[model samples]
Target: MKKILFLILCFPWFGMAQGDGLSSTVDSLYREDQFYVGVTYNLLSNQPKSLSQNGFSLGFNLGFIRDMPINKRRNVSIGLGIGYATNSFNQNLLITKDGAGGYTYSILNDSQTFTKNKFSNQVVEVPLEFRWRTSTPTDYAFWRIYTGLRVGYVFHNTVKYSGNQGDIKLINVSDFNKFQYGLTLSVGYNTWNLHLNYNLNALFNDQANIDGIPIDMNTLKLGLMFFIL
Candidate 1:
Protein backbone atom coordinates (compact mmCIF):
# COMPACT_ATOMS: atom_id res chain seq x y z
CA MET A 1 0.00 0.00 0.00
CA LYS A 2 2.88 2.40 0.77
CA LYS A 3 4.51 1.64 -2.62
CA ILE A 4 1.17 2.19 -4.35
CA LEU A 5 0.79 5.60 -2.64
CA PHE A 6 4.36 6.49 -3.52
CA LEU A 7 3.75 5.74 -7.20
CA ILE A 8 0.60 7.83 -7.19
CA LEU A 9 2.48 10.80 -5.73
CA CYS A 10 5.44 10.36 -8.09
CA PHE A 11 3.27 10.09 -11.23
CA PRO A 12 1.93 13.60 -10.96
CA TRP A 13 5.43 14.98 -10.39
CA PHE A 14 6.76 13.05 -13.41
CA GLY A 15 3.93 14.32 -15.59
CA MET A 16 4.57 17.86 -14.45
CA ALA A 17 8.26 17.50 -15.15
CA GLN A 18 7.51 16.26 -18.65
CA GLY A 19 5.12 19.14 -19.23
CA ASP A 20 7.77 21.66 -18.14
CA GLY A 21 10.34 20.10 -20.41
CA LEU A 22 7.98 20.28 -23.37
CA SER A 23 7.17 23.91 -22.66
CA SER A 24 10.85 24.79 -22.52
CA THR A 25 11.49 22.98 -25.79
CA VAL A 26 8.68 24.86 -27.43
CA ASP A 27 10.08 28.13 -26.14
CA SER A 28 13.49 27.26 -27.54
CA LEU A 29 11.94 26.65 -30.92
CA TYR A 30 9.98 29.88 -30.97
CA ARG A 31 11.35 32.56 -33.26
CA GLU A 32 10.86 36.26 -32.68
CA ASP A 33 12.12 39.01 -34.94
CA GLN A 34 12.06 42.35 -33.17
CA PHE A 35 13.58 45.20 -35.16
CA TYR A 36 12.33 47.12 -38.18
CA VAL A 37 12.92 50.36 -40.06
CA GLY A 38 10.61 52.30 -42.33
CA VAL A 39 10.30 55.38 -44.48
CA THR A 40 7.18 57.21 -45.59
CA TYR A 41 5.96 59.87 -47.98
CA ASN A 42 3.87 62.30 -46.01
CA LEU A 43 0.80 63.96 -47.54
CA LEU A 44 -0.65 66.95 -45.74
CA SER A 45 -4.43 66.59 -45.81
CA ASN A 46 -7.30 68.68 -44.45
CA GLN A 47 -5.28 71.81 -45.16
CA PRO A 48 -6.99 75.13 -45.59
CA LYS A 49 -7.72 74.49 -49.32
CA SER A 50 -5.69 77.62 -49.96
CA LEU A 51 -2.41 75.95 -49.07
CA SER A 52 -1.19 73.77 -51.93
CA GLN A 53 1.04 70.75 -51.75
CA ASN A 54 3.96 71.77 -53.91
CA GLY A 55 6.36 68.86 -53.53
CA PHE A 56 6.96 65.53 -51.93
CA SER A 57 7.07 65.38 -48.15
CA LEU A 58 9.39 62.74 -46.79
CA GLY A 59 9.67 60.99 -43.40
CA PHE A 60 11.88 58.30 -41.87
CA ASN A 61 11.43 56.04 -38.86
CA LEU A 62 13.43 53.44 -36.95
CA GLY A 63 12.12 51.36 -34.07
CA PHE A 64 12.68 48.43 -31.74
CA ILE A 65 9.63 46.27 -31.18
CA ARG A 66 8.87 43.74 -28.47
CA ASP A 67 6.63 40.89 -29.50
CA MET A 68 4.51 39.13 -26.91
CA PRO A 69 3.00 35.89 -28.06
CA ILE A 70 -0.65 35.60 -27.18
CA ASN A 71 -1.38 31.97 -28.08
CA LYS A 72 0.19 28.57 -28.44
CA ARG A 73 0.49 28.99 -32.22
CA ARG A 74 2.86 31.96 -31.73
CA ASN A 75 1.46 33.53 -34.89
CA VAL A 76 -0.43 36.29 -33.12
CA SER A 77 1.31 38.83 -30.93
CA ILE A 78 0.96 42.16 -29.21
CA GLY A 79 3.71 44.46 -30.34
CA LEU A 80 4.96 47.52 -28.54
CA GLY A 81 7.68 49.78 -29.84
CA ILE A 82 9.29 53.17 -29.54
CA GLY A 83 10.85 55.05 -32.40
CA TYR A 84 12.19 58.34 -33.71
CA ALA A 85 10.58 59.98 -36.72
CA THR A 86 11.12 63.10 -38.73
CA ASN A 87 9.00 64.71 -41.44
CA SER A 88 9.44 67.58 -43.86
CA PHE A 89 6.71 69.41 -45.73
CA ASN A 90 7.34 71.38 -48.90
CA GLN A 91 4.73 74.07 -49.37
CA ASN A 92 4.38 77.79 -49.98
CA LEU A 93 3.31 79.46 -46.76
CA LEU A 94 3.75 83.06 -45.70
CA ILE A 95 4.00 83.35 -41.94
CA THR A 96 4.27 86.77 -40.29
CA LYS A 97 3.97 88.20 -36.81
CA ASP A 98 1.27 90.83 -36.32
CA GLY A 99 1.40 93.89 -34.06
CA ALA A 100 -0.44 92.02 -31.30
CA GLY A 101 2.35 89.45 -31.16
CA GLY A 102 0.14 86.89 -32.89
CA TYR A 103 1.20 84.94 -35.95
CA THR A 104 -0.72 84.72 -39.20
CA TYR A 105 -0.48 82.53 -42.30
CA SER A 106 -1.12 83.42 -45.91
CA ILE A 107 -0.28 82.06 -49.34
CA LEU A 108 2.86 83.45 -50.86
CA ASN A 109 2.27 86.05 -53.58
CA ASP A 110 2.91 84.99 -57.20
CA SER A 111 5.88 87.34 -57.39
CA GLN A 112 7.31 85.79 -54.21
CA THR A 113 7.14 82.17 -55.29
CA PHE A 114 9.86 80.89 -53.05
CA THR A 115 12.83 79.08 -54.47
CA LYS A 116 12.58 76.77 -51.42
CA ASN A 117 9.97 76.52 -48.70
CA LYS A 118 9.53 73.76 -46.16
CA PHE A 119 8.55 72.93 -42.61
CA SER A 120 10.07 70.04 -40.69
CA ASN A 121 9.39 68.34 -37.38
CA GLN A 122 11.14 65.75 -35.23
CA VAL A 123 9.18 63.51 -32.89
CA VAL A 124 9.45 60.50 -30.65
CA GLU A 125 6.63 57.98 -30.94
CA VAL A 126 5.24 54.93 -29.16
CA PRO A 127 3.27 52.37 -31.14
CA LEU A 128 1.13 49.42 -30.10
CA GLU A 129 -0.10 46.83 -32.55
CA PHE A 130 -2.20 43.71 -32.71
CA ARG A 131 -0.24 41.66 -35.17
CA TRP A 132 -1.10 38.55 -37.15
CA ARG A 133 1.20 36.55 -39.36
CA THR A 134 1.14 33.25 -41.15
CA SER A 135 4.56 32.04 -40.17
CA THR A 136 6.29 28.90 -38.98
CA PRO A 137 9.48 28.50 -37.07
CA THR A 138 11.38 27.54 -40.22
CA ASP A 139 9.65 29.97 -42.59
CA TYR A 140 11.27 33.37 -43.04
CA ALA A 141 8.77 34.58 -45.59
CA PHE A 142 5.17 35.07 -44.52
CA TRP A 143 2.14 37.28 -44.87
CA ARG A 144 1.40 39.71 -42.06
CA ILE A 145 -1.05 42.41 -41.11
CA TYR A 146 -0.37 44.77 -38.26
CA THR A 147 -2.85 47.40 -37.14
CA GLY A 148 -2.17 49.79 -34.32
CA LEU A 149 -2.15 53.22 -32.75
CA ARG A 150 0.74 55.60 -32.39
CA VAL A 151 1.23 58.58 -30.13
CA GLY A 152 3.96 61.12 -30.72
CA TYR A 153 5.48 64.17 -29.11
CA VAL A 154 7.20 66.75 -31.21
CA PHE A 155 10.62 67.72 -29.84
CA HIS A 156 11.77 70.04 -32.61
CA ASN A 157 10.08 72.01 -35.37
CA THR A 158 11.28 74.52 -37.93
CA VAL A 159 10.20 76.41 -41.00
CA LYS A 160 12.57 77.40 -43.81
CA TYR A 161 11.87 79.86 -46.58
CA SER A 162 14.35 81.01 -49.20
CA GLY A 163 13.48 83.35 -52.01
CA ASN A 164 14.94 86.16 -54.13
CA GLN A 165 14.20 88.51 -51.26
CA GLY A 166 16.15 86.64 -48.60
CA ASP A 167 16.18 83.47 -46.47
CA ILE A 168 14.15 83.02 -43.30
CA LYS A 169 14.28 80.21 -40.76
CA LEU A 170 12.16 79.87 -37.63
CA ILE A 171 12.66 77.26 -34.92
CA ASN A 172 10.01 75.92 -32.58
CA VAL A 173 7.33 78.01 -34.14
CA SER A 174 4.43 79.01 -31.92
CA ASP A 175 0.98 77.40 -32.29
CA PHE A 176 2.49 74.12 -33.53
CA ASN A 177 0.81 71.18 -31.82
CA LYS A 178 3.13 69.35 -29.48
CA PHE A 179 1.13 66.15 -29.15
CA GLN A 180 -0.37 63.96 -31.88
CA TYR A 181 -2.01 60.59 -32.23
CA GLY A 182 -2.69 58.50 -35.31
CA LEU A 183 -3.83 55.19 -36.72
CA THR A 184 -1.25 52.88 -38.27
CA LEU A 185 -1.53 49.98 -40.68
CA SER A 186 1.03 47.62 -42.22
CA VAL A 187 0.33 44.66 -44.46
CA GLY A 188 2.38 42.56 -46.83
CA TYR A 189 4.60 39.53 -47.27
CA ASN A 190 8.28 38.77 -46.91
CA THR A 191 10.69 41.70 -46.36
CA TRP A 192 8.65 44.56 -47.81
CA ASN A 193 5.28 45.83 -46.63
CA LEU A 194 2.81 48.59 -47.32
CA HIS A 195 2.39 51.05 -44.45
CA LEU A 196 -0.16 53.79 -43.94
CA ASN A 197 -0.86 56.32 -41.22
CA TYR A 198 -3.73 58.72 -40.71
CA ASN A 199 -3.35 61.39 -38.07
CA LEU A 200 -6.38 62.13 -35.89
CA ASN A 201 -5.23 65.42 -34.43
CA ALA A 202 -4.86 68.83 -35.99
CA LEU A 203 -1.41 69.98 -37.04
CA PHE A 204 -1.77 73.33 -35.31
CA ASN A 205 -3.42 74.51 -32.15
CA ASP A 206 -6.60 76.59 -32.06
CA GLN A 207 -4.59 79.75 -31.54
CA ALA A 208 -3.04 79.52 -35.00
CA ASN A 209 -5.06 81.93 -37.08
CA ILE A 210 -5.04 82.94 -40.73
CA ASP A 211 -7.10 85.94 -41.82
CA GLY A 212 -8.99 85.63 -38.54
CA ILE A 213 -9.77 82.00 -39.36
CA PRO A 214 -8.31 79.18 -37.31
CA ILE A 215 -6.00 76.80 -39.16
CA ASP A 216 -6.89 73.12 -39.01
CA MET A 217 -4.84 70.55 -40.87
CA ASN A 218 -4.02 66.87 -40.55
CA THR A 219 -1.47 64.50 -42.07
CA LEU A 220 -1.59 61.27 -44.05
CA LYS A 221 1.40 59.04 -44.76
CA LEU A 222 1.89 56.04 -47.04
CA GLY A 223 5.03 54.16 -47.93
CA LEU A 224 6.94 50.90 -47.95
CA MET A 225 8.25 49.30 -44.76
CA PHE A 226 11.14 46.85 -44.46
CA PHE A 227 11.67 44.31 -41.74
CA ILE A 228 14.78 42.45 -40.62
CA LEU A 229 14.45 39.22 -38.74
Candidate 2:
Protein backbone atom coordinates (compact mmCIF):
# COMPACT_ATOMS: atom_id res chain seq x y z
CA MET A 1 0.00 0.00 0.00
CA LYS A 2 2.87 2.47 0.71
CA LYS A 3 4.66 1.63 -2.57
CA ILE A 4 1.47 2.35 -4.57
CA LEU A 5 1.05 5.72 -2.84
CA PHE A 6 4.72 6.69 -3.52
CA LEU A 7 4.47 5.85 -7.24
CA ILE A 8 1.33 7.97 -7.59
CA LEU A 9 3.00 10.93 -5.87
CA CYS A 10 6.11 10.72 -8.11
CA PHE A 11 4.24 10.42 -11.43
CA PRO A 12 3.27 14.08 -11.73
CA TRP A 13 6.75 15.21 -10.70
CA PHE A 14 8.39 13.07 -13.41
CA GLY A 15 6.06 14.41 -16.09
CA MET A 16 6.71 17.98 -15.01
CA ALA A 17 10.49 17.47 -15.12
CA GLN A 18 10.31 16.10 -18.65
CA GLY A 19 8.20 19.00 -19.81
CA ASP A 20 10.61 21.50 -18.26
CA GLY A 21 13.56 19.86 -19.95
CA LEU A 22 11.91 20.07 -23.38
CA SER A 23 11.04 23.70 -22.85
CA SER A 24 14.56 24.58 -21.77
CA THR A 25 16.08 22.89 -24.80
CA VAL A 26 13.75 24.76 -27.13
CA ASP A 27 14.50 28.07 -25.48
CA SER A 28 18.25 27.60 -25.80
CA LEU A 29 18.26 26.37 -29.40
CA TYR A 30 16.12 29.28 -30.68
CA ARG A 31 17.83 32.20 -29.04
CA GLU A 32 18.06 35.69 -30.57
CA ASP A 33 21.63 35.27 -31.78
CA GLN A 34 20.65 33.30 -34.87
CA PHE A 35 20.21 34.84 -38.38
CA TYR A 36 18.63 34.04 -41.73
CA VAL A 37 19.21 34.89 -45.42
CA GLY A 38 16.64 34.34 -48.13
CA VAL A 39 15.68 35.08 -51.76
CA THR A 40 12.51 36.70 -53.28
CA TYR A 41 11.10 37.01 -56.77
CA ASN A 42 8.62 39.77 -57.65
CA LEU A 43 6.40 40.28 -60.67
CA LEU A 44 4.77 43.53 -61.74
CA SER A 45 1.10 42.58 -61.51
CA ASN A 46 -0.64 45.92 -61.59
CA GLN A 47 0.32 48.95 -63.66
CA PRO A 48 -1.13 51.85 -65.59
CA LYS A 49 -2.09 51.38 -69.23
CA SER A 50 0.87 53.52 -70.29
CA LEU A 51 3.40 51.07 -68.90
CA SER A 52 2.56 47.90 -70.85
CA GLN A 53 5.75 45.97 -70.36
CA ASN A 54 6.62 44.67 -66.93
CA GLY A 55 9.06 42.01 -65.79
CA PHE A 56 10.00 39.79 -62.89
CA SER A 57 12.27 41.22 -60.22
CA LEU A 58 14.60 39.12 -58.09
CA GLY A 59 15.81 40.10 -54.63
CA PHE A 60 17.47 38.80 -51.45
CA ASN A 61 17.37 39.60 -47.71
CA LEU A 62 19.06 38.80 -44.41
CA GLY A 63 17.23 39.01 -41.10
CA PHE A 64 17.13 38.21 -37.38
CA ILE A 65 14.47 38.09 -34.72
CA ARG A 66 14.06 37.75 -30.96
CA ASP A 67 11.55 35.07 -30.14
CA MET A 68 8.74 35.69 -27.68
CA PRO A 69 6.72 32.95 -26.02
CA ILE A 70 3.09 32.41 -26.99
CA ASN A 71 2.52 28.76 -26.06
CA LYS A 72 4.44 25.64 -25.23
CA ARG A 73 4.81 24.65 -28.88
CA ARG A 74 4.57 28.04 -30.64
CA ASN A 75 5.97 31.56 -30.45
CA VAL A 76 6.01 34.94 -32.18
CA SER A 77 8.83 37.19 -33.33
CA ILE A 78 9.54 40.65 -34.60
CA GLY A 79 11.89 40.57 -37.59
CA LEU A 80 13.51 43.27 -39.69
CA GLY A 81 15.38 43.03 -42.99
CA ILE A 82 16.82 44.87 -45.99
CA GLY A 83 16.66 43.73 -49.59
CA TYR A 84 17.72 44.61 -53.16
CA ALA A 85 15.54 44.13 -56.26
CA THR A 86 15.92 44.75 -60.00
CA ASN A 87 13.49 44.22 -62.89
CA SER A 88 13.85 45.02 -66.62
CA PHE A 89 11.47 45.38 -69.51
CA ASN A 90 11.62 45.76 -73.31
CA GLN A 91 8.59 47.48 -74.94
CA ASN A 92 7.38 47.19 -78.51
CA LEU A 93 7.13 50.24 -80.76
CA LEU A 94 5.14 50.83 -83.98
CA ILE A 95 6.99 52.75 -86.66
CA THR A 96 5.70 54.74 -89.63
CA LYS A 97 7.71 56.18 -92.51
CA ASP A 98 6.87 59.01 -94.93
CA GLY A 99 7.22 57.96 -98.59
CA ALA A 100 8.91 60.09 -101.28
CA GLY A 101 5.58 60.28 -103.11
CA GLY A 102 4.02 62.08 -100.13
CA TYR A 103 2.23 58.85 -99.12
CA THR A 104 2.60 57.31 -95.63
CA TYR A 105 3.74 53.71 -95.07
CA SER A 106 3.20 51.90 -91.78
CA ILE A 107 5.28 48.89 -90.75
CA LEU A 108 4.03 46.49 -88.09
CA ASN A 109 7.30 45.25 -86.79
CA ASP A 110 7.24 42.19 -84.55
CA SER A 111 10.87 42.88 -83.80
CA GLN A 112 11.91 45.17 -80.98
CA THR A 113 11.99 48.49 -82.81
CA PHE A 114 13.81 50.15 -79.98
CA THR A 115 17.06 48.24 -79.97
CA LYS A 116 18.02 50.31 -76.96
CA ASN A 117 14.69 51.49 -75.53
CA LYS A 118 14.59 48.88 -72.78
CA PHE A 119 14.20 50.15 -69.22
CA SER A 120 15.40 48.79 -65.90
CA ASN A 121 15.22 49.85 -62.27
CA GLN A 122 16.80 48.83 -58.99
CA VAL A 123 15.05 49.15 -55.64
CA VAL A 124 16.13 48.99 -52.02
CA GLU A 125 13.59 48.13 -49.36
CA VAL A 126 13.10 47.62 -45.62
CA PRO A 127 10.71 45.06 -44.16
CA LEU A 128 9.08 44.96 -40.72
CA GLU A 129 7.21 41.75 -39.96
CA PHE A 130 5.73 39.40 -37.42
CA ARG A 131 6.57 35.70 -37.65
CA TRP A 132 4.56 32.93 -36.02
CA ARG A 133 5.25 29.21 -35.89
CA THR A 134 3.18 26.15 -35.17
CA SER A 135 6.03 24.51 -33.30
CA THR A 136 8.90 26.17 -31.46
CA PRO A 137 9.47 29.41 -33.35
CA THR A 138 12.99 28.46 -34.36
CA ASP A 139 12.67 24.72 -34.65
CA TYR A 140 13.20 22.64 -37.81
CA ALA A 141 10.26 21.01 -39.69
CA PHE A 142 7.75 23.46 -38.30
CA TRP A 143 4.97 25.30 -40.14
CA ARG A 144 5.21 29.07 -40.15
CA ILE A 145 3.73 32.20 -41.65
CA TYR A 146 4.60 35.89 -41.65
CA THR A 147 2.67 38.87 -42.87
CA GLY A 148 3.99 42.40 -42.87
CA LEU A 149 4.53 45.71 -44.57
CA ARG A 150 7.46 46.81 -46.70
CA VAL A 151 8.76 50.22 -47.66
CA GLY A 152 10.94 50.51 -50.76
CA TYR A 153 12.65 53.26 -52.69
CA VAL A 154 13.96 53.33 -56.20
CA PHE A 155 17.63 54.24 -56.15
CA HIS A 156 18.16 53.87 -59.88
CA ASN A 157 15.88 54.25 -62.91
CA THR A 158 17.26 54.15 -66.47
CA VAL A 159 15.39 54.02 -69.73
CA LYS A 160 17.03 53.59 -73.15
CA TYR A 161 14.92 55.23 -75.88
CA SER A 162 14.58 53.37 -79.15
CA GLY A 163 14.79 56.51 -81.28
CA ASN A 164 17.83 57.76 -79.44
CA GLN A 165 20.18 55.12 -78.07
CA GLY A 166 22.84 57.45 -76.71
CA ASP A 167 20.45 59.68 -74.81
CA ILE A 168 19.10 57.72 -71.84
CA LYS A 169 16.23 59.21 -69.92
CA LEU A 170 17.61 60.31 -66.60
CA ILE A 171 15.09 60.54 -63.75
CA ASN A 172 16.21 62.36 -60.64
CA VAL A 173 14.03 61.29 -57.75
CA SER A 174 14.34 62.46 -54.14
CA ASP A 175 11.70 61.80 -51.52
CA PHE A 176 10.40 59.08 -49.27
CA ASN A 177 6.86 59.59 -50.60
CA LYS A 178 8.21 58.33 -53.91
CA PHE A 179 8.87 55.08 -52.07
CA GLN A 180 6.46 52.15 -52.40
CA TYR A 181 4.32 50.59 -49.68
CA GLY A 182 3.24 46.97 -49.87
CA LEU A 183 2.01 43.89 -48.05
CA THR A 184 4.08 40.70 -47.77
CA LEU A 185 2.78 37.16 -47.21
CA SER A 186 4.81 34.02 -46.67
CA VAL A 187 4.51 30.31 -45.87
CA GLY A 188 7.27 27.97 -44.84
CA TYR A 189 8.15 24.47 -43.76
CA ASN A 190 11.29 24.13 -41.71
CA THR A 191 13.90 26.29 -43.48
CA TRP A 192 12.20 26.78 -46.83
CA ASN A 193 9.59 29.46 -47.52
CA LEU A 194 7.47 30.74 -50.41
CA HIS A 195 6.30 34.32 -50.75
CA LEU A 196 3.73 36.51 -52.51
CA ASN A 197 3.67 40.27 -52.29
CA TYR A 198 1.60 43.17 -53.66
CA ASN A 199 2.58 46.80 -53.90
CA LEU A 200 0.07 49.33 -52.65
CA ASN A 201 1.92 52.36 -53.96
CA ALA A 202 1.83 53.72 -57.47
CA LEU A 203 4.90 53.20 -59.63
CA PHE A 204 5.36 56.84 -60.54
CA ASN A 205 5.30 59.70 -58.14
CA ASP A 206 2.39 62.11 -58.58
CA GLN A 207 4.76 64.82 -59.71
CA ALA A 208 6.48 62.58 -62.22
CA ASN A 209 5.89 63.81 -65.77
CA ILE A 210 7.36 61.88 -68.70
CA ASP A 211 6.39 63.39 -72.07
CA GLY A 212 3.36 64.66 -70.16
CA ILE A 213 2.34 61.03 -69.53
CA PRO A 214 2.17 59.71 -65.97
CA ILE A 215 2.44 55.98 -65.22
CA ASP A 216 1.51 53.75 -62.30
CA MET A 217 3.43 50.63 -61.33
CA ASN A 218 2.44 47.59 -59.29
CA THR A 219 3.89 44.08 -59.24
CA LEU A 220 3.18 40.52 -58.03
CA LYS A 221 6.14 38.49 -56.84
CA LEU A 222 6.61 34.73 -56.43
CA GLY A 223 9.81 33.35 -54.93
CA LEU A 224 11.39 30.78 -52.64
CA MET A 225 13.12 31.59 -49.39
CA PHE A 226 15.83 29.56 -47.66
CA PHE A 227 16.18 30.41 -43.96
CA ILE A 228 19.61 30.63 -42.37
CA LEU A 229 20.19 30.23 -38.68
lDDT of 2: 0.53
Q: What is the TM-score (0 to 1) of candidate 2?
A: 0.61
**Per-model CA lDDT versus the true structure:** 0.79, 0.53
What tens-digit string does per-residue lDDT give for candidate 1 at 42-145?
99887775688788788887677788878888899898988888898898776666679767788776788678888899999998988899977655568899
TM-score of 1: 0.84
Best by TM-score: 1
Q: Clashing residue pairs in candidate 1, if any?
A: none
Q: After superposition, how far is residue 225 of candidate 1 from its true place, in Å?
A: 0.9
